[model samples]
Target chain A: MQIIFQIIFSLFAIAALGLVWRRRADGLLSKHSALWWSIIWLAVLALAWYPNSTQVLADILGIGRGVDLVTYCALAFLFFTIFRLTIKIESLQRDITKVVRRDALEKNNI
Target chain B: MIMILVPAHNEAKTIENVVKQLLFVGDKVVVIDDGSTDDTALLAGNAGATVLRHTLNRGQGAALETGHTYARQSNADFVVHFDADGQFDFRDIPRALASMKEKNVDIILGSRFLGKEQKIPWLKRAVILPFARNIDRLFGSVSLSDAHNGFRVMNQRALNFIQLTQDRMAHATEIPQLIRRYNLRYAELPISVSYHEFGQGPIGGFRIVRDLLVGKFM
Candidate 1:
C-alpha cells in the first residue's frame, strides 16, 4: 500500500512539472516563476521517491516526523506566497490609479 | 491660483453646496467626482466647479490624488482639501490659509480638538479618534491633535513635495508622515466639524490601521 501511495505521489509531481513546462512554453509564466515552480515540483518528486529522506533533516530540526516537517514547510510557503501576492495586488492597484488619474486630468485640460 | 480640491463620491446631496461654499473662499474649486452613480459630476459642474470624473469608484484617497495632480498641472499656488459631506465650514478656508502664512508653515491641518469643541459623535470623540491618533503617531511618526481631519491647506512647496500613494482613507495618516519626512512646516488650526451622521466608526479605523501596516511592512 505504501509503495502504491509513493507511485501516486510521484506521478502527481511529474504531472505538475509537465504542466509547468507547458505553461512556460506558452509564455503564460515568467521565466523566473517557471524555474521556481520547476524546482518546487522537483523537490516534491525527490521526497516522493525517497519518503524517508526528510527524516534526517526533520530530526536535525527537532521535528518528530518527516511528514510533519513537510506540512509545516508547506504552510509557511503558502503564507509567504500570499504575502507576495498581496503586495503585488497593491502595486497593481496604484498603477491603475495613476492611469485613471492621468486620463481624468487629460480630459479636463484647462 | 489657490484651488480648493473636493473629492466626492456619491455625495450629490451636498456636492453643489460644498462647491459653491468653497468657491466663495477660493479662486477655483475643482471637484473630483469619484465615480459616483449619482449626478455628482453634473451638479458640481453646474455649480461652477471644474469637475473631473473617474470612470470607476476608486476610493477617496485616489480621488484626492487626482485632484492634486490637476492642481499641480494648473500651477496652483495653494490647494485646500475639503470634505464633500458639508461637515466642514467653508469659512475656515481663509482662516487656514492665513494660519499657514502667519505660522510660516507650508501645511495647515484643521483640528477638531483645538479651540472650541465640535459636535462630534460621542463614540468617535471618545474612542476611535484617540486610538487613531496613537496609531498615527506610531506609524506616521507625527504627533497630531487631529490625525484624520479632511480639511487641510497646503502651499506650493508642500504641493510639490507631498505625493499621496495610499488609495484609501489611509491617506490622512500618509499626509502627516509625508510632512514629517519631507520636512515641510506644518501646524494644526482649530476648526469645527458638525457630524450629521456617525463618520468613520471603529471598523473604518481598523481598516485604516490595516492599510497603514500593510503599506509599511508589506
Candidate 2:
C-alpha cells in the first residue's frame, strides 16, 4: 500500500514538475498527440495503484474482480478522448465561421 | 507603414538582438511574447519594439494570429513574420514588399533551400523537404518551396484568407493548405539559413514522422 502510494505520489509529482518546467521542456508534449499523452500519464497512475484498485475495477469490467484496472483505465481514457475531440470540434466551428465571414467580405470587395 | 511580427517564447537571450535588427530596417516591430517566463518582452520593449503578451504559452500559430489581428486592427499594409531566434535576414524585407508590388503575390515565403549556399540542417533537407514537397504534390500545389519556413511576409488579403489555427509548430504546415484552399497567390524567395549555432541539433526523425502521421489522420 505504501509503495503504491509512493509510486502514484512520485509520478504525479514528476508530472507536476514537468508542468512547471514545460516552457523549458520544449517538444515534450509538442511531439505527441495530447490524447496519447493523457493516456500515458493516466496509465502510469493506474499501474501504480493497480494492486489496490484491481478488485473494484475487475467487477466493473465484467471479468474477475482483479482485472478491472486496465478496463477502468481504458474507459477513463475514452472519456478524456471524447472530451478532447469536443474541444477540437468547437475550435473547428469557430475557424469555419471565421473563414465563412472573411470569404464573404473578400467577395464583396471584388 | 511596415509592422514586423516576431513570435517568441522563452527567447530572452536572442529577442533583444532581433528587435534591434528589425528597428535598423526602419520598420515598426511588434514582438508577440507568447507567455515567456523570461525577460523576452521586457528586453524587446526596451529595444524599442511594441510587445504583446499571451497570458498562456500558445503555439506559434496563435502568436502569428495575435500579431495578424493586431496588425489588421492597426491598419497595417504588410505584416512580416520574422524569427525571434536571430536566424532571419532583415535585408530581404524590402525585396518581399517589392515582390508584392511587382508580382501581386499575396504571400511571400522565404526559402532557405532555394539559395545557392543554403544552410538548412541535413535532416530537414533530407526528410522534411521531401515530405513538404510530397504533401504539396498530393494537394496539386505548384510554385511553393519550404512552406513550413517560419519566416514569411503576409499581406492584408492573405491574412484575411489564411486563417492559421494549428497554433503550434504545425502552423508552418497549415499555411500552404490555407493558401491552396483560399486560392491565395503565394510565392517563395530564397533566404539564407544557418542552423549551426549553439543548442542546434537534429531532432529525432521518428518524432517528425509521428507528427506527420498524426496531422495527416487527425
Candidate 3:
C-alpha cells in the first residue's frame, strides 16, 4: 500500500510540473530548465523512497508518517524556487543584449 | 521623460564617474548591480542614482534586464542604456534622443566610425569590427558596422517593442535580429569608444559565442 502511494505521489508531482511548464513555457527554457529540474525531482523521489532516509528525516523533524508528506512539499518548493530564479536570470541577461544591439542599430542603420 | 539604465558588476572603480556623467541628461538614472562583491551598488547609489541589487552574480545580461524592467515600470517616455565602465560621453545623449524623435525611430544606436577623431583601439577596427560586420552581412541583414555597442536610446515604442528572448551576449548579436524581427524603426549615429589606458581584450568572445549557442537551445 505504501509503495503504491509513493508511485502515485511521484506521478502527480511530475504531472503538476508538466502543467506549469506547458502553460507558461517559453522557447528553449521549457526544455533546458525542465531537464535540470527533473534531475532534482528525481533525487527527491529517491529520498522519499529510501526507508532509512525517510525515518531519519522524520526523526530530525520530530514528525510521524508525516515525513513523506513533508519531504515531498519541501522538495517541490526547493525545485520550484530554483527553476523560477533560473528563468528570471535568463530574461535579465536578454535585456542587456537587446540594449547593446539597439544602440548599434541607432548609429548605423538609422 | 528619459530614464538611463546602467547595468554593472564589480565596476566600483568606474561606476560612480559614469553615473555623474549620465546625471547631466536624463530625468532619472537607475543602476542594476548584478551581484557585485565590490562597492558598485553603493557607489552608484551614492552618485544619486537608484540602485537595484541581485543576490547573485548572474551576468551582465541579467543586470540589464533589471534596469529595463525598472525603466518600463516607471513609464519612461524614452530609455537609454549606459555602461558602468565609463567609456562613452553622455552629452551625446541629447543628440541621439533628438534624432530618435526627429526620425520617429524606435531606437537610435551610436557608431564610433561617424566621427573623424573618434578615439578607439586599433585592434577593434582591425579584428572585432570586421568580424562583427561580416556576421551582420552574412547570417543577418543588420547592415551595421558594429553591433556590440552599449550606447543607445529606445523610444517608448521600441522600449516596449523590444523582446529580448536572448539572455546572453547573443543579445548583442541579436539586437539587429530582433529589430528586424519586430520591424522597429532604428537609427545608428557616429559614436566612439575609449579604450582604457590599460586595454581589455576583445570584450566577450567566448561567453558571447557560448551564450548565442545556448540561446538557440533555449
Candidate 4:
C-alpha cells in the first residue's frame, strides 16, 4: 500500500513538472514562475520517494510526526498564497474599473 | 450649473420618475446605469437625462465616480448625489444646496435622524445606523448624524477633490473620510428618506463594513 502511494505521488509530481515545462516553452509562464513550480514538484517527488526524510526536520521543529509538519506547512503556504492573490485581484479590479470608467465617459462624450 | 447625478442599478421601475423629478431640481440630470439588464439607460435617456452606461456591473460607488467625472468635465457648479430608487425626496435638493451656501460648507449631507420625522425602519434606526456611525467615526475621523446618506450636495470644491475608489457601498463611509482628511466644510441637513422593500438591510450593512475593512487594508 505504501509503495503504491509513493508511485502515485511521484507520477503526479512528474506530470505536473512536465506541464510546467510545456507552459514555459509556450511562453505562457515567466521563467521565475516555471522555476518556482519546478522546485515545488521536485520537492514533492523527493518526499514521495523518502517519506521518513521529513521526520528529522519535524523533530527539530518539535512536531511529533512528519505528516503533521507537512500538513501545517501546506496550510500556512496556502493561506499566504491566498493573501497574495487577494491583493493582486483587488488591484486588478481597480485597474478594470479605471478602464471601464474611461470607456463609459468616452462613449457618452461626457 | 447644477448636475443631479443618480447612480442606478436595475432600478428601471423607479428610474424614469427619479430622473424626471430630479430634472426639476438641477440644470441637467445625469443617470449612470451601472450595467443594469433592464431598460434603466433607455428610460433615463427618454426622461431627459444624460445617460452613462457601465458595460459591467460595477457597484454604485463606481457609477457615482463616473458621474462625478462627467459632472467635472461638463463644468458643473454643484453636484447632487441622489439615489435612483426614489427613496430620497427631490424637494430636499434645493434645501441641501442652500444649506451648503448658507453654512459656508463644501458639502451638505442629508440626515434622516434630524428635524422632520421619517419612516426609517426601526432596525435601521435603532441598531444598524448607530453601529455604522461608530464605524464611520473610527475611520472617517468625523462624527456625522447620518453616516451613509445617499442624498448629498457638493460644491465645485468637493466635486473636484472627493474621488471615490471603494467602487461599492463603502464609498458612503469613504466620502466622510475624505471630508475629514481634506478639511472640507460639511454640514448635515434634516432630510427625509422613505424606506422601501428594495433598499439595503442588516446584511448589507455587514457587507459595507467588510468592504470598508478590506478597502482600508488592500
The lowest-lDDT stretch of 10 consecutive residues in candidate 4 chain B is B192-201
> Best lDDT goes to which candidate?
1
Per-candidate TM-score, first chain only? Answer: 0.88, 0.44, 0.38, 0.93
Interface RMSD of candidate 2? Answer: 10.0
Predicted candidate 2 versus true structure: per-residue lDDT over B1-218, tens digit per residue: 78899989999998998899888774689888877899998999999988777666766777788778777777788889888988877888888888877888999998876778776666667776776667555644554666467778888898787766555655666678778878888788887765635321235323333344445544
Query: How well does each candidate superpose onto the true structure, as a TM-score?
Result: 0.96, 0.64, 0.64, 0.93
Candidate 1 structure lDDT: 0.90
Best by DockQ: 4
**What DockQ does each prediction reach against the true complex?**
0.65, 0.04, 0.06, 0.66
- Candidate 4: where is the Cα deviation over 4 Å? none
Q: Quote model 3's TM-score for chain B.
A: 0.91
Model 3: residue A54 alpha-carbon error in angstroms: 45
Task: Enumerate residue pairs that collide in model 1.
Answer: none
Q: Please write out the lDDT profile of model 4 over residues B49-140, one tens digit for every residue.
A: 99998999889999999999998899999999999999989999999877888889999988988888878778888888899899898786
CAPRI-style class, candidate 3: incorrect
- Give the DockQ of candidate 1: 0.65
For this target, which candidate reaches the highest TM-score against the unseen true structure?
Answer: 1
Worst 10 residues of 3 chain B by lDDT: B197-206
- Cα error, candidate 2, residue A49 (Å): 28
Candidate 4 is scored at a TM of: 0.93
Give the C-alpha miss distance for residue B206 in model 1, angstroms.
2.4
User: How does model 2 score by TM-score?
Assistant: 0.64
Which lDDT value does model 2 have at B44? 93
RMSD of 3: 13.7
